[model samples]
Target chain A: MPRYRAIIAYDGTDFYGWQVQPGKRTVQGELEKAVNQMAKNPEIPIRVQGSGRTDAGVHALGQVVHFDLPYQIPANGVRKGLATMLPFDIGIEQVDIVADDFHAQYSAHTKTYRYQLSNREFRAPFRRNYTGYWPRRLDYDKMAQAIPDYLGEHDWISFAASGFQAKTTVRTVTDVKISQEPATQEITFEFTGTGFLYNQIRIMVGVLLEIGMGTRPVDDIPRLLAAKDRQQARLTAPASGLYLKSVDY
Target chain B: MPRYRAIIAYDGTDFYGWQVQPGKRTVQGELEKAVNQMAKNPEIPIRVQGSGRTDAGVHALGQVVHFDLPYQIPANGVRKGLATMLPFDIGIEQVDIVADDFHAQYSAHTKTYRYQLSNREFRAPFRRNYTGYWPRRLDYDKMAQAIPDYLGEHDWISFAASGFQAKTTVRTVTDVKISQEPATQEITFEFTGTGFLYNQIRIMVGVLLEIGMGTRPVDDIPRLLAAKDRQQARLTAPASGLYLKSVDY
Candidate 1:
């Protein structure tokens, strides 16, 4: 048996999430179906392990996953098979052969996620689908300055969702970047870290949004992280604007 | 009554086009309802007219519209009022006082619609929502060559959707500019015309697509326009990739 790794991209609108459930379309189920139907051994069950799970309406640009096959299907053939079998919105970005023991989640290095915000009084119609549209005035420079505070190892329990009960909330975020594209109303937040707690990106965006609006001081980010209480952080940003941009392993 | 022209933008995904209809959420109806509700005179009615109708899933960056008001409301008030009163997807970009007889549709000089096509085998999840996910091979250089055939006064009945009963199918398309953005698979078709027939932009894109894929000769465009039959055209692209980019009055 051989193992193959794939980079996936999907418009998360029609999907329930990455994992499939009964009666709902999901990225994992689609890939499994496509692989099983096309592979030499149609009976071979595939366990497609993704880097992480994204909420509904969120998107992925470089989501990494891996699965084992009973026969050798060329990397390009695997890509073409999944692409032809999947819907127009979901696609296999790249396919490569990998070690049998290679696990997408465990063999990992760092992951990066991006959240896009439209800082304009009126949102651009074409951009509204992917960006979080907020009419409030936002100070982009201040937000960019405040983004660095989230770097280093910190107990981000405050930013975690109330429903999320992780054993360890401490994660080392190597870099956090928030930038505004000049002459345009688009602002993007990029986070690179070994791991992230549940709802971490949403909460980080929410806190930065508060800072951008001048409702919170830049220095307050450290205090918020120290609080370690979910209620201490700002409200979570909408899922529609977040994306699992890349998984660098 | 003082008439004010309002520049509006909206994400048309959840909208049932721009026209008002029963059991459908339309941009026109939402704006009209919001304005009519805010009117000082409850008995009097108000209707908002847009520069043109944008079909469902189509976007607009510079769409102009206006409606007469029973009493004078500050431009800022109109912006804040409709934004707060109406749905979050639609927004009033700008507002100003226009001439007494200013009609958004009839007063328009040049209406430019951009037809976006993505020439990539793998559809980008991020861009799939905005661009038409065209997986076929396209000779962009050939597509550009076909533009000159549409740059003149010609009957565009063949470009229109069937059952569009118009008084005159003849429309003077002053210019048709097709440009490809380098380093990406983005192809933009800018149609600057006095007016467009129903589904004209999509049809024009379809003709270019045929030429791009080598299905039809680039020289056949002029002959197709002269034929005045919808069957002569290859196919009409989807409405999601079309945009009313600007309306210069």
Candidate 2:
């Protein structure tokens, strides 16, 4: 058997999420089905493990996954074959045969996530599936000033949503940045970290947006982190705007 | 009665076309429905007349239309009401009341159309709805060199598609430009003219792409125009990549 690792992209508008569930369409389920068809073995089924799960309607640009195949095939062949079998919304960007001990989930060193905001007065029809809408003026300087506080290692319990059973809340964030396009008024938030807890990025975005909206103080990020209370971050940004930008091993 | 002119945008993937057909979803049909709902008058049904028809799967950024209502209403109110009633794929960008002589189709003016091509080794899932796929390298300079031949008044019979009733084949092309985005490998061709025959822009794009692909000569534009034959311009670009960019009154 040969273990193959692949990087993929998806629209995520129609997918339930990245994980497989009975009677629910997901990225993993669709990819596994394609892989099984290519394997053409009824006795042995192939299972794929993703680096992490992206919630419903969250897109990905370079999601990594590892799976074992019964037969050895060239990486390019596997990429072309899987692409032919997969739906139009999911794309296989790259594939490589990896060592038997390599794992997609545990071996990942860092992950970069991005959140997009369409800060316009009206919702654009073509951008509905890709960006979150914020129909108000945002103080860009205030948001930028608040972003640095999120860096370094901290217990991010305040930003994590309920129901995720993580071993520990301590996570190291390596970098954070925010940029805005003057022509479109689209704001983007980028974060790179060792790992993120469930809904942490979205909850953090909610607080940052509040600060930009002038409803919350500029120094709210440190206070929220110190409180370590999920209730402190009252908003969780919509999943449509979130994207897993890349994973690095 | 108040006559209003509105600039609209649409995804156009699900629409049959810009024109209304029986039992078919269309941009015009949807706009009419919304206008009628707002008018709330059975004696008179409001009809929207677009500046021109965009084929199925052809998007628009600033498509202009004009319609009359039974009662007087503020321009902003009409824009907001119609936007609320229309589907997410179609958008009302700007609306203004105009004089009775103002017309969407017959008004004296210019129209701009743009075609987008995703020139890459693989088709991006997210760009499927908006860009035409061309999985090959293109010579940008060659395409740009051929563009100037398209300017000035000429008999554009070679570029026009069949089945259109036009009084004359003579048309003046005011401007033509080709631009490429290095980061995304997306190429855009924009054309501005007094008017265009049915399927003219798509055929023009086809010829330009052939030039870029090295299949046709860079100086082929003049010969094709002189030939005055549609078959000489055999390639018609996909409708998904075409956009009615704007209209000038």
Please give the C-alpha DockQ score of model 2: 0.71
For candidate 2, list the clashing residue pairs, or say none.
none
> For all the predictions, what are the DockQ values?
0.49, 0.71
Which tens-of-lDDT digit does each residue in B65-121 have in candidate 1? 989988788888887787778776786778887788999999998898888888887
Each prediction's TM-score versus the true structure = 0.91, 0.94
Residue range A1-249, candidate 2, lDDT tens digits? 899999999999999999999999999999999999988854868898999999889999999999999889999999999988899889899999999998999999999999999898777989888998788889999999999999999999999898878889999999998999989889999999999999999988999999999999999898889999887887888899999999999
Candidate 1, residue B131: how far the Cα is off, in Å: 2.3
**Top-scoring candidate (lDDT):** 2
Total colliding residue pairs, candidate 2:
0
Q: What range of 10 consecutive residues in model 2 chain A has the weakest lDDT sum?
A: A37-46
lDDT of 2 by residue, B1-249 (tens): 789999999998999999999999999999999999988854767789999999899999999999998888999999989888999899899999999989999994899999999998778999989999888788999999999899989998898897777999999999998999989999999999999988999899999989999999999999999998888997998898999999998
Q: On a 0 to 1 TM-score scale, where does candidate 2 land against the true structure? A: 0.94
True contacts kept of 2: 0.65
